[model samples]
Target chain A: MSKPTAGIFGLTGCAGDQLVILNCEDELLDLVNLLDLRDFLMATSANDTRCSLDVAFVEGAVMSRRDEETLERIRQRSRFLVAIGACAVWGGVAAQESNGNHAALLEDVYGPLGRQYDAIPARALHELVKVDLNITGCPIEKSQILAAIANLLQGDPPLLPQYAVCAECRMRENNCLLIEKGSVCCGPLTAAGCEARCPALRIPCIGCRGPADDVNTASAWAMFEEKGYTRADVDRKLRTFAPKGGRA
Target chain B: MSTTIRIDHLARVEGHGGVTVEMEGGAVRGVQFDVFEGARLLEGLVKGRSYEDISPVLSSICAICSVAHSLTSLKATENAFGVEVSPQTEALRDLLSLGESIESHALHLFFLAIPDYLNYPSAVALAADNLPAVQLGLRLKKLGNTIQETVGGRAVHPVNAVLGGFGRVPGFDQLAELRAALAGAAADCETMLEIVAGLPAASFFRAGIAFGALVSPREYGYYAGEEVTMALDGESETIPAPEYKRFTNERAVPHSHAKHSTYNGRPYMVGSLARLVVNRARLGERGLAAMKRLGLRFPPDNPTDNNKAQAVELVNDVDRALRIVESLLEHGLKDEPPVPVAPRAGAGTGITEAPRGILIHSYVYDEAGRLTAADVITPTAINAASIEDHLRRAAENAAPGEEAALTRAFEMIVRAYDPCISCSVHVVRRGHDG
Candidate 1:
């Protein structure tokens, strides 16, 4: 049997998710051996853009026409397309509430010349294409990325934790920063795979992993408001990293 | 015959960028290092957002150097609010920055550029033959990530570090662990320098370009510098960070998403090359020894030598990191809460030497602490014109009809700079006075 063909592509974000794949310093050599890696521009100069891929890990949001074209080409050639990180699954930080004046924003950076780039409002991968799996994180956590790859390699659909970050925070025996400290934490609304990284350090969750499954949106909002945060503040925190539908 | 040599989708570098060199009648007419990455108007995105949210978003500009962006953003915000952090905070931030520089340089020299020098398609191919080299690179890279994870919370986008100080400072044990790691890696760092010195010279050298980097009146440092020093053909000028616009005259250009920058009407260089050129005198004992052993001359004209410069800096970074760790451990750890911030209407600029080069973050906040205006100048943007100049010379020197060789040469030239296209295209407009 031939090894599974894999290609990791980045679109229009920090390239952090892809860097996470590289940060798998120990597993990287083994990963390349297990997968018939073809296209990973960030990692290699020898890339085959036309090669059919068994698994395509795509990061970054579709923030431009060029990105859309790149995604379409990759999607066309790949059997399993996994959206990695908050940027590809959700709109990430680039998709913040500043879309109303995106035109003005572009102009502000490039003067009138920004019009030539023909940039679109940042949108997640699923918004434009069919995503088979979604691994969410600001930069996808190392364990989660490795696990997803291992599962996919075995022809098993990767199982993502559907629990909220608060559950993991509880598991870590960390005090609830939201309730105890009255910080503007988003643990109740966030997906659990990061081991509650920020809150573990007494910092509030910025919700980089998008939304949790079966989360009570109404109660989450009420809890935040009860902790002295206004509805606007809660909404702002939610929109910071939550996917499009995850926002209130 | 005139031909346009386009290496679209430049590989083995961070983000999306390509090189387009136009050859006309054997003379290189022009060259454009096009950044195909999408315009992430991060400055615009953070317009009405609170000050705290700005760095988190902007830091995502480049994952490889996220710590640099985060620290610079925090400094800019801190400067704006007139916040003064404790020495511990300053020391820890410096340690984190050095960690990033070491990691970035290691990644570039081994995984990225070494493949080119060794004539391999990628590190994966190189690893098939040279496993130990690849393993050493991984160890060095992991060391970087560990420091970042320990200090900033996560390796990529840090969460614990905020405006005034860290949300949770690493304990004495954590600092000691870093020191032990540095001590263990001392021999490895020397081995790294040897590996760097072994590579065949890239031979892409020229003079007349300006070199710029953040300079400290104190020690050779990144975060310690409030002023920038630019040297061209032996003459140098030190400009305050607030007047960065004078040096980084950024403007938009056709055929590239990122803008081009200039100093004194000439393309200027930054990054490890510029850092070494500007601060060679202030190098620590280890760095000076490494330079002497490596036989590196001052004000190297070759961009490819940047990799070697990075290797030398890697040793220095480790040396500096160990000292910082020792200082922290000696002083004992303090669990200080983030300093209280009261935002007022004012504008401030934070400048630091990111791994790739100088990174600047400037912002204006209203009385409510909401950002009113912003401007960011990444090192890649600053090096854009300088990159083109090198590409033009490389193309001019290339044998006609050897498109493959020319393309390879151009790619090597660009990659040597380790241009982070993701970071460069964030913002260009510099005159955003609040």
Candidate 2:
């Protein structure tokens, strides 16, 4: 059987998630051999953007018309399309101010020069096109990505935990940062699979993984309020990565 | 006859950008380095957010240089609030920056820039014939990540270093392990130096250029000092960091998303070459020795020599990291809490040498500690004009109608700087631009 071709792409966020794949020092060479890596622009200059692929892993949010067009093309070409970070899964931090006037923001930053480039408000991959799977994190965890690749190669669907990050924190025996330290944490609302990395180090979880399945955002906000966080703080924390809809 | 050379999607660089070189009748008409990545409005988003939230928010600017952004934001915030951290904390921050330098420089020199020299399309292709070199690059990168993960909690967007100090210090055992790794990596640095030296010399568009970098009186500046040293026209001057606005004179351009930066009305260079030129005397024994082995001299006029300068910095980073780890071991790692901050209305600037070059993050806060304004100038933006200048020169000198040669020349010049488009696109707000 011929090797399955795979492509990696970035749209409109920090190309950190793609860098995460490169960061897998131990498995990178072997992974390249296992699958026919086709298009990874950050790693190589020689790439075929037009080729069909068995799997396509894309990072970043669709923050412009060009990005949407790119994602649509990738979705059509690949049999399985995986959104590989919070940016692709939930628009990431770039979408935090989607409600604001993008033109004004651009003008504020670039003045008249901002009009030269066209951009739309940032949105997630699922909102624009079909996404077969999501590997969640601000920068997706390397182990989770490796596991997903393994599962896919074995002809099994990639499994991702739908539970809140709190479950993983408890399993790791990390103290409840919200209750114990009075720090505002979103572990109860964030997706699991990161092993509660931030909370383990005494830093509160900032919800870089986006919301968990059926999370009670209102209750989470109430809990933060009980911990002496202001309403603005709760709203800011929730909206930081994946803000609700607004047009550009 | 008019010929246009366009790279719609420039590869091997961070984020998204492209280049276009237009020539009319064999004379170069124009060269534009364009960043089409959608504006994230990072500066505008940070507005009204509390001071404490700025670092984490801005750290998203670039994953590879997250520590640089985090550290610089923290420094600016602390400076605004009149907070001072312990010397140990400062040393740890410096070590973290050095780790970033080692990893970033290794990745660029081996994976991105070396392929151009060997006439290969990519490092993966180069690896088939030369596995050891690729392995060595990976080893160095892994070591850098290990240091960042151990000290800052995670490799990308570190969560440990916060406010005025780290949330938790690495244990003695961890520091010793890192020290041991650094000591072992010395030979790898030598090998890297030899590899870079073996590559054919690049002499595309050599020009006398002004170089900018931070200057430290105490040591080689990475996470230290508030003064900048500028080398222009064979003369040097030291200016306060706050006076950067006076010299940088950042302005927006229509053809690109990133703002163009100029020093004294002309584009200047920054990054490894700039740092090395400005602070060559402060290089430790290993760093100086690596420079000698690489046959590099100060004030290199060719931008392509930045690759050699980065190789030298790899040695400096490892040597400095080893010294820092040993000192921490000797003093016994202290678990000190972050310095207390009293919120007040003020503005401050944080400048540091990111792996690519000097990165500046300046912010203004209201009395309630909410961010009122921000201006971030990335090294790539500072080098954008200089890259174009080189591209134009390369295009003008290329054999007429030799499109492939011109493209190769342009790519080499741009890649030599290792520009990070993600970091560079953060808009700078000059007076009333908002």
Candidate 3:
């Protein structure tokens, strides 16, 4: 019997999802004992650029050309690769304002007048390589990351519920944002698992849950529009944090 | 024969970034603590957006400090609109900033920097072995999150925490309960300070800085201040943060998205240690007493001292919050919501001491309230050159050519300054380019 090897990598993100893993606090020591930890830059002073591993947990969307290379390198070395956040699952902010003039936005942020650190527009690591799973959220949820890790360790596939936040809101018995608050929400089209935390706070859901599976965006937008939001307003809400072409 | 190490994606220091060290000839040839963590470039994109759109958009710059970002954007908007938050607005914002400090610092210490000193995979490991300290850290972190949620309405990319103070300020009773929690933690903070002081010193380059902090002339500076100066040599000019670019030179190199900054082309320091060094006298009886108990000095250059200094600040902040609550209770409530002023068309510079260090936002707005041009220089950028200088010195001081030794030394310097790459990027390069 051999210990499984694991490496964790982060890209264009706040590193929150990774922190969530670290937030496991005490559970990690016993948990890590089950596997041989390899190449976690945040934890240890000793790390290698390459490693043989059973699992590689990746955070952040592949944004830069260099990032594309890093993503490819991970895919090459690891047996299982899990995309850990919205950035990695989708292109994230690269796709955030994609509907807006991307070229103009790029110019504003990258050049024509901005600082020079030229990069190809952001795209998810999945676009370039195989991503076995996506633990999606703006920064992704900690509980999900923990669950996914447990599943991997158990040789069982993680059951990521493919439902909109609306379903979860119903489960919590909270009032619907659309019906009660007259707020525009992407909850109907966005993924669940945050337990509809944002709408619970009395604020509109900004679609940080990432796009729900096979979401009927057209129907959701039509419903939102019928609720009195104009096409432009509904369009903005759908595109807030969803990936490119993800919105209806 | 010197060995250099590069840390890609420094996890849990509040965003996308990394550092690279270059060793040469058995010495640190040059180091580029580079942050190539792909910039979303919030400031660059907000140019043509409407006044209302700025706060919500920039607030997502980094999910961890979203409230601080929201407040900064709103303050910039207020300046553009020439609207003042009533005193209540100021108070609420101050409280949120305090919240930001607690949350950000706790996260830094517990998740990001602590594992190095304590020898663990992460704070998660420390929770069981060192449950009390970890629990206290989580409690304080939660208090920050709780405050943000109460005021801003949610944590991580908050809204309703807009310009002109909050959409709805907390009532007197709510403020009291919050204060009570802060009060309950006073003894815990004292214990944490003592614990932090026990952490070993981080080896840092010993070049002293002419420390510049917010000397409010009223009280221990938290938010408002016009001009503050260090007791440097006579006749030294006190350059403001608006002039921060000139005082702390900002430049870019090929390896990173973040620009490196230096004070007069040399590294300086900011945040808790720097703040205490500059304003120890005004630290009231409690702060002074805590300082004495902690045994900190005025001319502290070592970055590792920050761990101790943070514990010191945790004490001061909780003390301050409790006092604020008591004062409000006694003084009675009043009707005010961020001061009101005409949206005067002009250029302005607004600087506040974010928990990390001085955060400066300078902008030019048209009469119609458009951010025609904007520049946001976070405290991390200010400390970039200084971090590099410290790394270089730390590496030289290390037994040369040893990557682990060099990394341990460099990591200590970075942890001490607590530079936020999510706010700014740094490129540590070894030697001049070939």
Candidate 4:
């Protein structure tokens, strides 16, 4: 059987997720052997931007008309379109102030020339087109991306962690950061698969991975409030990566 | 007759940008490098966020050099509040920046730029023939990531390097392992130097260009610097970092979303080449030996020599990082608490050299520590005008009908700078275009 062809792309956010794919040092050579890696522009000077693929993994949010058009074209060509990181899954950090005045914002950044490019509010891939799977994180975990690819190769849906990051913390026997240090951790609401990395390092989880299934947002908010955080603080933490109304 | 050459999507470089070369009557009419990536308005988003939230938010500017952003932001915030970090913390932060420098140079030289020379479409295709070089590149890159992951927590957008100090320091065993890794990679580092030096030299865009870089009084500076040294008109001048706006008269252009920056009203280069040109005397013994072996010299005129400069820097950074690790181990690791900061109303400027070039982050805070204003000048934005200048010259020299050759030349010049468009576009100032 022929190898499954894959194309990796970036949209609006930092190219962290795609960089994470390249960060797979031990597996990168094997990955190229396993798949017909077609269009990774960041890693190769040669690319077929219009090539068809069995799987397409896209990072970053749809923030411009060009981004929307590119996502649509890729969606039409690929059998499976996977949203690779927080950006594609939930609009990422670039969408944090999506409701702000874009024209004024552009003018502020680019002065009079800001009016040159056409831009719209950033949106997730699933909001504009179909997303077969989402491997979530500010920068997606290397192992999860590899796992997702393996599952796709087997003609099966990739298995994603459905529980909150707190579960993984408990399994790792890490002390509860919120309870022990009174730090406002988002572990109770954030998705697992980061191996509770931040909490292990004694830093509270800022929820870069987005919310997990059955996330008790109200309880999480109350927990923050009880810990002396204001409503605004709670809102800001939750909405930093995956803002409210991000879902399609 | 008139003809125009367009590269709709420039591949291999970070972020979205393109080039359009217009020729009329066999002379280059005009050239424009357009950055069509959506404006993220990072400066606007950073407003109202507290000093503590600044680094993490700004860290998202570019994943490739998140450490640079986060550290520079921390430095600015610390400056605002008058916080002093421990010597250990400073050493660790320097190591983190070195790690990023190594990773970025390897990725750019091996993965991005080398393919153009090998006549291959991508590094993966080139890898089939040059497996050892590719493997060595990855190994070197991994070492850098390991340093970051060990010190800052994760590889990208680190969580440990906070406002005052790290959230947690690495263990003795971890530092030992990293030291051993750097030691093991010395021979591979030499191999990389040879590989880059062996590539064909690019001489198209080498005339009448000035260079800018951050210079420290102490060592081959990446993290510690308060003054910038610029080589202009066959001489150099040192200016304080806070006065960068005077040198970097940033303004917008119609063709690109990213702002164009000029020093003393002239386009100047930055990054490894600029740093090497301005501070070649600071090269350590290992770095000096490598330069001697490769027959590389200072004040290089060609921008493509930036690749060779990065190879030289890779050796310097590894050697410097090794010495730092040894010093820490010699003095013994300490889990010193971060210096407490009391927020005050003041403006502070922090500057550091990202792997590409000098990066500056300046901020103003209200008495409550809420950010009222923010400005960032990335190396790429500063180099944009220089890139255009080079492209215009290269296009003018191109044969009348050779579109492919012109496109190749344009791409080579742009890639030499290793511009991160995402970081460059983060600059937003609230004022009318003057």
lDDT tens digits, residue span B1-434, model 3: 54548766554455545567777775566666665556565565566555655666666556665666677667666765667666666766666776767766776776667776776656656765987787777777777666665666655555656656654456678777887888887777777776677776665466566555655555564565545454332223466645556654666545443455555555566688877876667666777788888788767756777777776777777677667667766777663443444554677666667777766666777676667777776777777766766777776676644666666666666776776665662232222111
Question: Ten consecutive residues with minimal summed lDDT in candidate 3 chain B?
Answer: B425-434
Among incorrect, acceptable, medium and high, the docking class of model 4 is medium
Candidate 4: residue B311 lDDT (0-100): 89
Measured on C-alpha atoms, candidate 1 has an lDDT of 0.85
Better of 2 and 4 by DockQ: 4
> Candidate 2, after superposition: displacement of residue B307 in Å?
0.2
Model 4 TM-score (B-chain only): 0.96
Candidate 2 per-residue lDDT, tens place, A65-92, comes to 7888889999999999999988898888
Interface RMSD of each: 4.7, 4.6, 4.9, 4.3
Per-residue CA lDDT of model 2 for B1-434, tens digit only, reads 98888887788999887888878997888778877777787888889898888999899988888999999999888888888899999999999998888878888988899999999888899999999999999999988888898888888888899997987788899998998999999889888888988999888666787899988566674888788888998998888877788667877665544567887788888999999889889999988888898887656778899999998889888988999899899989888878888889999898999999888899889999999999888888888888888888888767787888778888889999998988876543111111
Task: Give model 3's docking category.
Answer: acceptable
C-alpha lDDT (0 to 100) for residue A48 of candidate 2? 86
Q: Is candidate 1 or candidate 4 better by lDDT?
A: 1
Docking class of 1: medium
Across residues B64-98, which tens digit of lDDT does each residue of candidate 1 receive?
Answer: 98998999999999999999998889888888988
TM-score of chain A of each: 0.96, 0.93, 0.89, 0.94
Please give the ranking of all candidate structures by lDDT, highest first, separated by commas. 1, 2, 4, 3
A230: Cα error in model 4, Å: 3.2
Please rank every candidate by DockQ, starting with the best.
1, 4, 2, 3
DockQ of each: 0.63, 0.56, 0.25, 0.57
In candidate 1, list every pair of residues with a backbone clash.
Answer: none
Give the best candidate by DockQ.
1
